[model samples]
Target: MVFAPGEKPGLEQDEVKLQKASKQIVQTAILRALQQVSQESQQRQAPPKGGPSLQLERGKLTKKHEKK
Candidate 1:
């Protein structure tokens, strides 16, 4: 099909749109992966909820044993 002057062919337009959509999808996937990795790293760096409590309990037990 012949396009008028200064107009793009339908197939060219469709290809451009497809390229843009694929790029966006790839970007989104990369961002999600990075976010997941960051969350996992943070979780590893942060202590568990039970950590402080366990430490406190151990300290108490030590004091009690020392008193004997």
Candidate 2:
């Protein structure tokens, strides 16, 4: 392909549009990744769901139907 004087090759309007679209795609991916990281950090900082755990002490229970 031949270009007129003072004309830069490989930088046509279509190429500029393509470059812009590629940049936007990269930016969107980065933004999504950052959002995911932020959400994970927030979840980690949040408290655990449900009530506290239950524990049994030593000798706390006896076998049922056992003779005295």
Q: Backbone clashes per model, in order?
A: 0, 0
Q: lDDT: which candidate is best?
A: 2
Summed over model 1, clashes come to 0
Off by over 4 Å in 1: 1-8, 51-68
lDDT of 2: 0.72
TM-score of 1: 0.60
Q: Estimate each model's TM-score.
A: 0.60, 0.56
lDDT of each: 0.71, 0.72
lDDT of 2 by residue, 1-68 (tens): 99999888766987889999999999999999999999867765663465432332484643334244
Cα lDDT of model 1 by residue, 1-68, tens digit:
78788877687879899999999999999999999999967765774663332222644632213222
Clashes of 2: 0
Model 1 pairs whose backbones collide: none
RMSD (Å) per prediction: 10.9, 13.4
lDDT score at residue 61, model 1, on the 0-100 scale:
32
